[model samples]
Target: MTIDTQSQRAEHSPLRRIFGSVFAILQTRLELIGIELAEEKDRLLGVLFLGLDAMMLATMALIALTALVAIAFWDTYRWQSLAGITVVYAIAALVCALKARNGLVNSPIVFEATLAEFEKDREIFRKP
Candidate 1:
């Protein structure tokens, strides 16, 4: 009679099983987090755009009022000084807008995290 040496198989170590379960949970959580982040990013972009539009409309209103007021007080204070102040305000607004634009274009942590989540999900689903 031959010995049934091949009948028994080694079980996965407890540590290995725990690690695998932890990894799977972490990956699933990360994917959920990524989707949330993407949604948040979209929301942020929408708010930013709305704010920019409002700012532009307000600036235009202010400029029109300034023009009317300057015309009314043309004989008292120099129009040149009023124009100079408007120029300064415009410059400041420009600088702030540029900084905001830069922040939007450069920050990619949200997108990166979303991409990583997608990759993990893909790997998980691809397994046969």
Candidate 2:
């Protein structure tokens, strides 16, 4: 009887309860992190495929347009027309590169929600 009673008391001890609560919180946070990671992965893959498709189409259009422009000025100013087109393309490439750099630099942090949840947990634990 005494052994059974002690066992029951130990199972329902405050320390055990605290540990269980902490484990539950950790499990919930881990699940949240997993969900956020999956979402980010999906978003990144979508952007990657769309961006590649757009770039391919744009490159085809630009090539066709460049050929047309060069043919239009072939007899009179062939070299000059090609040079002008090359310069314009170079400038546009530079602008796009700069914008891409800025976008990467300014992009939101990954796992933002996970970090926030951890911070909240820290705050909760810090209180008496």
Candidate 3:
């Protein structure tokens, strides 16, 4: 029996070439998108951590400053020192409370982006 290599190659050459090209493009696109998403996730986490660290440092600084000021005023008028410390604490607490509230407000934006990504992945997979 003669092997019909020429006929088989002719029938499949164009289709196989086109399919290989399409698959290569799709794979490249998927890899690029994954890398971008990873970078974005890293950046988001870094920002969140920085914000948290700043808030913590600010809180500590406020407390330390108030204590120092209170000690300085303690010999003159204990009431004045106590009042100053109280005001400092109040202001710091108010700021921290507002920041906590803002964090809650910003969470929805993050959730929306996450949900959108999930939807896109779902759609991609659902497509034949």
**Candidate 3 error regions (>4 Å):** 1-4, 65-128
Q: What are the runs in model 1 whose C-alpha is more than 4 Å off? A: 1-10, 13-16, 80-128
Error of 3 at 42 (Å): 2.9
Question: On residues 1-128, what C-alpha lDDT tens digit does candidate 3 reach at each position?
Answer: 13588888888999999788768756765666677688779988999999899979988997788778778887888788788678867897799799989987876443444456557756876899
Extract clashing residue pairs from model 3.
none
Point out the worst 10-residue segment of candidate 1 by lDDT.
1-10
Cα lDDT, all candidates: 0.77, 0.94, 0.77
How well does model 3 score by local distance difference test? Answer: 0.77
lDDT of 1 by residue, 38-116 (tens): 7988989998899889989988987787887688778987677587768978898899889999988997565666567
What range of 10 consecutive residues in model 3 has the weakest lDDT sum?
108-117
Task: Give the per-residue lDDT digits (tens) of candidate 2, residues 10-95.
Answer: 87898888999999999999999899999999999999999899989989988998999999999999999999999999999899
* TM-score per candidate: 0.52, 0.90, 0.49
lDDT at residue 46 of model 3 (Cα atoms) = 100
Candidate 1 local Cα displacement, residue 109, angstroms: 12
